[model samples]
Target: MTKLTLYNNLKTVRAQQKLSQSKLAEKVGVSRQTISNIETGEFVPTARLALLLCLALNKKFEELFYF
Candidate 1:
């Protein structure tokens, strides 16, 4: 099976919305470093966290993350 890489436009979208990593993290109930990790591809968020991020950013899952 082929491995799929997850990619996101999180930083761009967050910047466009004028949200700081800390602020977004707070909204999603995670630490600022967690948000940084996700943005840098050092960590992939859990399904629940992904959903929370989507809700917090007002973005669809596909809009935030993709293969």
Candidate 2:
């Protein structure tokens, strides 16, 4: 089995939108620590969370996450 690495430009996008980690997390219904983990590649968000992030950030799925 292959171990896949997921990649995201979340920090850049979040900064571009002038949102703090806590703010984005709140909008996406997650905790700030979770957002920090996600940004650092320590956590991978579920499908629902991904969609929520897109809705909140006005980004496409591909534009945010990929593996």
Query: Which number leads on TM-score?
Result: 1
Alpha-carbon deviation at 24 in model 2, angstroms: 0.6
Taking every candidate in turn, the Cα RMSD to the unseen true structure, in Å, is 0.6, 0.9
Off by over 4 Å in 1: none
TM agreement with the true structure for every prediction: 0.96, 0.93
- On a 0 to 100 scale, what is the lDDT of residue 62 in model 1? 98
TM-score of 2: 0.93
- Candidate 2 displacement at residue 27 in angstroms: 0.6
Model 1 per-residue lDDT tens digits across residues 1-67: 9988888889988999999999999999999999999999999989999999999999999999999
Candidate 2 regions off by >4 Å? none
